[model samples]
Structure formats: structure tokens, C-alpha cells
Target: MNTRQLLCALTVCSTLASTAALAGNAPLQQVQKKWAECQYSTPDGDEKEQCFQHAITRIGSYLDKEPGNPELTVWLAINKASLAGAQGGLGALSLAEEAKSLLEGVIETSPQTLDGSAYTSLGSLYYKVPGWPISFGDDDKAEEMLKKALEINPAGIDPNYFYGDFLAEEGRDKEAKVYLTRAMQASPRPDRPLADKGRKRDIEATLGKLK
Candidate 1:
């Protein structure tokens, strides 16, 4: 082809590529906004759950458009897991299982992408409920996941707080106290709450027991 024709072709190609990139980012940005909303939707647990679900739906769609987006997939999984925790009931188990699988896929793709958030979700899944007759709670798994989370983000309040609860529930208050104190130290503010209040209360009660 002529030089001018080749240059025109390259410009068109670049424009199309840029447009596709912008399109991919559009959904991701929307999903992230919803995720931030979910973080502070504490007073209305159900609303918080719905906000996360909205994030999942949006991010899931983004993943459909960009199937190999490991970070987005992990975020979607974590949000779904959070939704399950915010509104735990009959069907929440199924949702949690789905989140677990998605996060596992994220780990498979890139363990580094299985960040503190992903591990925290897994930890909560295991820590919050009971086994079999009760649900999907297993303190052993909780400890494992939470420890993994802390390994990734040791300064994270969620990991420290929940891991403390896990230890306390297992009657290991000595170790649990270390985590609880760290959680309080990491606490953001009254404006931006940490994890779930109920979970935080559990952590406090566990610490109280330890004291």
C-alpha cells in the first residue's frame, strides 16, 4: 500500500483500539463506584448487600466483555462474598460458594491478584457461619484464610479483626488479643467504618473475654 494509505489505516486501528479500551473502562468505573457505596452502606445491611450485588452484576458484565481481566474478576468475587455476608440467609451459602469459586479462579490465574480483599472474603466465608447443619462456617478454614490474608496485607484491619475473632472462638485468646489491638489501631474513623459492625462487636467481645 502507499505510505499515506498505510498511515490512515494505522490511525483508524488506533482509534478503534482506544475506543475499545474506553468501553472496557466504563463498566469497571461504574462497578467501582458501587463498590465504594457498598463499603459505607453499613446502617442498611440489606441496602449494602444490594449495592454489592449491583457491583457484581456490573463487573460480571465487564468480565464478559473482557473475559481475562483477573483483577476485575477478583473484585467481582469479593463483592459477591461481601453481599453474602451482609445478608446471610438461606441462599447466601450458594452465593458464597460461587464467590469462592471465582476467587479460586483468580488465584489460579495469578496468586498475587488474590490480594488482602480476596483472602478476607474467604476468611469471612469460613468464619461467619457454622458447619453442615448450621452452614459454611469452619474455624480451621477461617484461620487459614485469614492468615493468608494477613500475609498479603498484614496492616489490614479486616484480617486482623476477623482473625482475632477466629482465634477467640477457638479459645485462643492470648493470640487473639494481638490481632484485636491491631484492628483497633487500624480503625479508620467514625466517618469510614471498618468491616461489619457485628463482626467488630464480636471482636470486641472476644477481646473483652480475653481481658
Candidate 2:
């Protein structure tokens, strides 16, 4: 099999392993760490696309087979959105909407203690998707989603970094500074240093533009 197919297969196996382990009393974080490793192992573009697709199938199956599995539903939606850029066209748009709906449902149903991953995933989807004024790429929605994610998990670097970019793009340099600074400080792991560096670049660029 090609790289994409291999990554997809690995993604499916990891997802199944994670869910089964979750069901058997293993720590959720440990399972998630392995999932993150699989995600990072795949290169961007097609390989990543296949990984997300496999994630959809595995997580979606869990959601359907296991009634009242709120967390799995959130994960399914989260991964569905992950393939947006690779999928492209109308199909991508539909998948994005599907992800958004599931995330919204999770927020509505789990209110006080919804999963932080859902918020970050939704933030990512809105932040990346491009469209006309009323359709997609809503800075307002992106801001709300990222902010909600950060509120849920103060140490989350992704939300802060992305929000910083959004604010910088919207000409909110001063405000963006705070988030970018926080993002640099909230780096989730040493291996993923670009997130912090990219946000720092945005911060500097925004400052330059403002000056």
C-alpha cells in the first residue's frame, strides 16, 4: 500500500485500540497520546487526509454502536473536520457542516463540562475553512470557538495560537499580542515548536503593521 493507505490503516487500528482500551479501564490520556503520535507521523495533505478519514470511520462506528457515547461522538466530528482541506469541494463542505453539528450538540448537551477537544476541533475547522462572507471563515465564530476552548483548558496552546492568528488578521494587534504570548508559553510539547514560533511571527508581524 501507498503512504496514504498505510497511514489510514494505522489510523484505523489506533482508533480501535484507543476505544477498546478506553472501555477496558486504560487511561484516556495514554490512548490519546498514541492517537496523537499516529496523527503526527502522517505527513500533511493526502496522508493526513486518509488518517482523518479512518478516524471518522472508527469513531463514527463507535458513536453509532455505543449509545450515549458523548465523548466518541465529539471525537468523530473532530476528525471529520480534520480532512476538510484534503477532501475539498462540496463533499468537504458537507463534512465540515457535519462536524460542526456534532460539536454543537455536544456543547448543548454537556454544557458545564463539555470536552475541550471538541472546542479546539471546531475552532480549527472554522479557522481553516474559506468561503464568502455569510458562508464560512467567520472570524467572529472562530474567535468564539478558540476562546471557549481556552476557557475550558487554560493550558491549551492550539486555541491560543490560532486565535492569535485570527486576531492579527483582523487588525487587532494589541489584543492579539496577549494570545500569541500565551500560545508561546502554552506549547503542548517540545516536538511541536512551530506553533509557538508561528504565533510569535504573527505577533511581530502585527506589531510591524500597526507601527
Candidate 3:
């Protein structure tokens, strides 16, 4: 090939490589945005359940391509947890269990990924699910994981909010108020307006319960 033709081909290849790298995480971000929409914007009902189901399928496809990626795995877990909430029955238990397993795997392999989101999510499952013969819920484990998450991302909204909710559930109203207030005052996430709004509303409701 001529020198000029070789140079043009090299430039094309470089541009394509750059473009591919830039878009590498685009699918992950899209899944995250869709999850926020499903969790925060969709009302609790069959429609919400369907939304989560679709998200699970999409994330599953991404996982098939990226396999064992902490970010995708965590989102897959998050979607399953949300689906469990929307399902809310014996069937929900299995989804929650799956989510718990996925989050545990992420924590074991990449504890610091997504700013300790795996810890936050695992802690949430620990407290929210049933216990004993029913499921694996354990308040003490929940506290430990949530506290670890807080240590990693002290000002993060999800960790603070989940920890506050756990505290509220444990009847530590004053402590719950402290964390919930911090969560409410947290800086808004540029890409997560719906989640921020919904979480603040939740904090307000939880605070009202203390009053």
C-alpha cells in the first residue's frame, strides 16, 4: 500500500478505537438510568414490575457480554432487588436471594466499586428480607455492612439513606434522623435527579414518622 493510504488507514483505526473506548460504559450508564426511572418514577404496580423485568433482561444481556464485571453485576443485583419489592410474595424471596448473592459476590471481588454500593445494597437486603426459616435477614449483619459502606462513601446518598432507614427500623429514631438529614442535604447527583427526589421524599416521610 502507498504511504498516504497506510496513514489514512491508521488514522481510521485509531478513531474507531477511541470511539469504542469512549462508549465502553455507555450501556452500563443507560441501564442505571433506566433502573432509576423504574425505581423512582414508576408507581408500584404491575407496570413497575414489568419495567424491572425488562431491566433485568437488559442487564442480563450486558452481563453475558461483560461477565463478572462488578458494575454490571451490581446493577443486576439492584434490578433483582427492585423486582423483589415489586413482586412482594413468596416469589419475591427468590429474587431477593439472587440479589443478595450477586451483591455478596461483588463485595467479595470488588468491595470498592461504585463507591461501596455493593455494601449498601447487601446491607439493605440483610435488614429488609425475612429471617430464620423464612430468609437470611439479620439486623446485625445489616448494620455492619451499612457502616462499612458509610466508611467508604461517607456522604453518599444511598448508603446514608439505607443506614438511616435501618436505624429507623431498629427504633433508633434519633440516630436515624441524623443520617436521614445528612442524606437529605447531600449534593444532588447530576445524572440521578429522579432517584434524588424520590430518596429525599422518603427521608421526609421517615422523618415525619419520628415526629
Candidate 4:
């Protein structure tokens, strides 16, 4: 995949994995389910954009009620990133910037929240977005954030999968396969069947590419 396609794929994958962190919160769980449907089940087009927009609105209402909640804030960021991937263009960069800001806030206040999901999401954004004049994509920063996420959640599916994908993107196939394998073996989240299933597919697809 080229840069733009890789960016969108990684963006969408990171969004799916991050939702697992919110499984314990009932309202957030609803949002997570809706996101899975919109991302994996819905066809890519105007319809998918509307689905994400509705999800963004729902997440916004929850954020308004629990302004101090890191989990809710992370979900808001995740949905916004997903929307940005769906609506690719000049406007997409603005949405991605907003998402980055939200995730950074969570990292500042609650880096350990949701098993360091903010770090994983932020890492994915850093590596996937363009660098310099276009956006803030930085390999060094991405590696740092992703490694920090792994330090916090060594056995988590999202961190492993994201780190693996990052490595693969950088042409480090052997190291990437190791992390992808670990991601596949991650303990299932009982409350997040859809997210788990979807993540498994992502892991498998990435693994296939390494072959």
C-alpha cells in the first residue's frame, strides 16, 4: 500500500483496537459496538461517513456529561480519527489534528488509563500521518509512544498489533511478525467480542503480508 492507503488502514485499525479499552463502561460499550458496525460492517462511502458522524455525535454527548473521563475522551478521539479516515481530503487533516489533540490530553492526564490506549492510538497517528509541511508523522516519536504503550500493557492486543504493524510498515518484517503473533494470542476480552474478532482479522491480515 502507498502512503495514503497505509495511513487510512492503520488509522482504522487503531480505532478498532482502542475501543476494547472502553468495554467496561456501558455507554462507551454501546459506542464501541456502533463503531465496529460502522467500520467493519458498513460499506465505505457516504453511508459509512454518516454512520461515523452519528457515532461522533453520540460520543460528544457522553463527553459533555463526563468531561473529566479519560475513557470517554479517548473514544471521542477514536471516532474522530475514524471519521477522518472515512472522509479523506484536506478536511481530513483537520479532523486528524483534533483527534491527536484529544489523545494527547488523555496521555498527559491519564497515560495509564485504558491500559495505555491513548499512547497506542497516538503512536499510530504519529507514524501514519505525513511529516513536516503536511502533518506530524515522525518515526522516532511513533516508536517511542508505541514502546511506551507496550511497557504499560505488555499483553494487550491493541498495543502489540499496532507496534507490529508499525514495524512492518518500516520493513522490519521479522520483528513485526513476532508482535503480530503475540497479538493473535492475546487473551480474549469477554465483553468485547466484536472488537476482539475484528482485531484478530487485522492481525491475520498483517501477518499474511509478512509472508
Candidate 5:
């Protein structure tokens, strides 16, 4: 994988939305907006990391106040995962671990919460992180959780993209192309223009690689 593909692979901690059609709390919305800018529009790695850290801090405060607020907790996990993606290596392992914990908490709040996004993201983390004594990456678990995510969100863009990317890396090119094409066909989130655009780039790149 080259630079963009590398970025896409790391950023599997991509956008996560609320379970309901209703608007999320203000803090969650702010974090999502900043996350998008860092993930896509912002070009500087340091700047993007800074943005993600800021979101981590900001969302952390909300989580502190609310304690068990499921919405805030999920976004906190997402931001932390974003930080992990930005930082990479051993330092990223710590951040991803925290993300996993927070995501689990969110799932406990409700299994189907965030349209099973906790499962989707946690699944992505398992596959993306380094394996063994180094970290807890597990391909079997990744597939299981990702398939669960698809059951919850069959038409969701992120789950399809990550699953397809995983299959491509595993050299399951035909099956990977099927999911990537489905991802391209998935509905766009009007609230997340930059995320949608960036993911499309990833989907397209992965498709080109398979061909």
C-alpha cells in the first residue's frame, strides 16, 4: 500500500453516527465535524493529530460530566480511535485499547446502539492493530464483528468499506470488489460530506488495486 492506501487502512476508525435519526448532542456533533476535517480536508499530519487530540479532550470533558452518557461515550471512543489512527505504532496501541473499552461501554448501553457502530469500529480495530504479544489484533474476531455490523447496517458505507478492504488485503479480490462496489452504492450521509468523499476515494483506490 502507498500513502493514501496507508491512510485509509489506518483510518478505519472512520465516521460513526448516532443510532437514531435525531440530531446528536452539540458536543458529539462538534467532534464529528472536527473528525471529518482531520480525516479528509486537513492535509498536515501534525495538524490533523492536533485536531483529533482536541476532539479527544473536548469529548472527554463531556464524558466526564455525563459519566455513562452513551452518546458521549461512543464519540469519545471514536475520537480516541481517530487519535490511534493518526499516531500509529506502539503509542497507537494504547489509544486503540482505550477506544475498545469505551466502545464496549457503549454497546453495554444498548447492543444495537449507533446501528452497531461500536461493533463495526471495534472490529476494524482488531484487524488493523498489530497482532500477538504486540497487540490484540485477531482476523477471526474482525470478520465476526464486521458481519454483525453488516447485519445491523446492511447498507452502511463504513462497514462495507472496511470489510472490503480486509478482503482485498487477504487477496479475496473478487469478494472484496463485491463489497467495495456495494460501499460505493451505499447511501451518503448529508451531514458528512468530507467523510463520504474521503471514503469514496478509498473505495475507488481499493477497487483499482483489485483490478
Candidate 6:
């Protein structure tokens, strides 16, 4: 091929690649915005639960188109988990398990995807859910997974906070305080104002009890 023709072909390919990248980003961005709005702006426990329920519906629409996309799967799991957390009690057990399964799938597909969020999330669930014949909670597994998460994202707020919370549950308040303090000092995420603020509150509330 002529040099000019080759250059034109390269430019076209580049443009298409860039366009596809933007197209991919748009849906995830929209999903994130939806989550932030629903989780951050909404007040009242019942209302938040309702909002998350709606969030699952909104995210589920995306999954309909890209069911196997790891990004979409993680977000769907997150949305369901949030709904369950807001609901609380026995009714949320099934939802939590569903989140656990989705996260496990994400780990299989891409363990380090989203900065190892799948591992962090799964670890949090292990501690939060009820154990024994009732649910999947296991302190040993929780610690193992949380430590793995820390290895991947040591400076991340969520992993530190959850690990600290788990320690507190196990009566390791001193160790828990260290991690919680670290969680407070973790670098900020500009795009995650709601999650950061909420997590900070969790850290402070936990720390307050330790003191």
C-alpha cells in the first residue's frame, strides 16, 4: 500500500478504537452516577432501600446487554449488596449470598479487576453475613480474603475499613483502631464522594467506640 493510504487507514483505526473506548466508559460512568445519586443523596433507611432496589433495576438493564462484562457484574453485585445492607435482617440474607456469588465469579474472571474490589467486597461479606447453618460467614475466610485485599490495595479506604471492622468483631480492638485510623487517612477519591463520606463516618463511629 502507498504511504498516504497506510496513514489514512491507521487514522481510521485509531478513531474507531478511541470511539469504542468512550462508548465503553459511558455506560459504566452512567452506572456509577446512578449509584452515587441513589446511595449518597437519598435519606431515610426505607427510602434508601427503595432507591437501591431501583438501582438494581437500572443496573440490571445494562447487564441485559452486557451480562458477561466484569464491570457490569461487579456493579450489579454491589447494588444488590447495598439493597440488602439497607434492608438488613433475615430478608437480606439471600441477597447477600447473591452478591457473594457474583463477586466470586468476578474473582474467577478477573481477581484484580477494579483494583481488587471483588476480593475486598467478598471479604466484607464473609464477616457481615451470618454464619453456620444459616449463612456463609466465616471469620477465618474473612481474614484471609481481607488480607489479600490489603495486599492488592493497601491504601484503599474500603479494604482498610472493613478489615478494621472485622478485627473489632473478633475483639481485636487495638488492631482494629490502627486500620480504622488508616482508613481515615487513606487518599481521597474525587469521583467517590458519597462512598468516601459514608466510609469516613463508619471509621469515626467505630473509632469513637474504641476510645
Return the TM-score for each candidate structure: 0.68, 0.65, 0.88, 0.86, 0.85, 0.84
Worst 10 residues of 3 by lDDT: 18-27
The C-alpha local distance difference test score for the whole of candidate 4 amounts to 0.90
lDDT of 6 by residue, 1-211 (tens): 9999999999999999978876867877777777777777888597898888887888788788887888878888888888888888898999999999999999998888777888888888898889999999998999998999999999999899999999998889999999999999999986667778877988988888774
Q: What is the lDDT of candidate 5?
A: 0.84
lDDT of 5 by residue, 89-194 (tens): 6978889999999887777777687788888888888898888999989999889888988999999999899899988987899999989999999998887788
Ranking by lDDT: 3, 4, 6, 5, 1, 2
Model 6 Cα shift for residue 48 (angstroms): 1.2
The Cα local distance difference test for each model comes to 0.73, 0.66, 0.92, 0.90, 0.84, 0.87
The regions of model 5 sitting more than 4 angstroms off are 1-24
Clash counts per candidate, in order, are: 0, 0, 0, 0, 0, 0
Best-fitting candidate, measured by lDDT?
A: 3
Off by over 4 Å in 3: 1-22
Model 3: lDDT of residue 49: 98
- TM-score of model 1 vs. true structure: 0.68
Model 2 ranges off by over 4 Å = 1-39, 112-115, 131-134, 187-211
Lowest lDDT 10-residue stretch of candidate 6:
29-38
Q: Which wins on lDDT, candidate 2 or candidate 6?
A: 6
lDDT (Cα, tens digit) per residue for candidate 2, span 157-209: 66676677777777787887787677667644543444345445655664466
lDDT of 5 at 121: 87
Q: Which scores greater on lDDT, model 3 or model 6?
A: 3
RMSD of 6: 5.5
For each candidate in turn, give its C-alpha RMSD to the true structure in angstroms. Answer: 9.1, 11.3, 6.5, 13.0, 12.1, 5.5
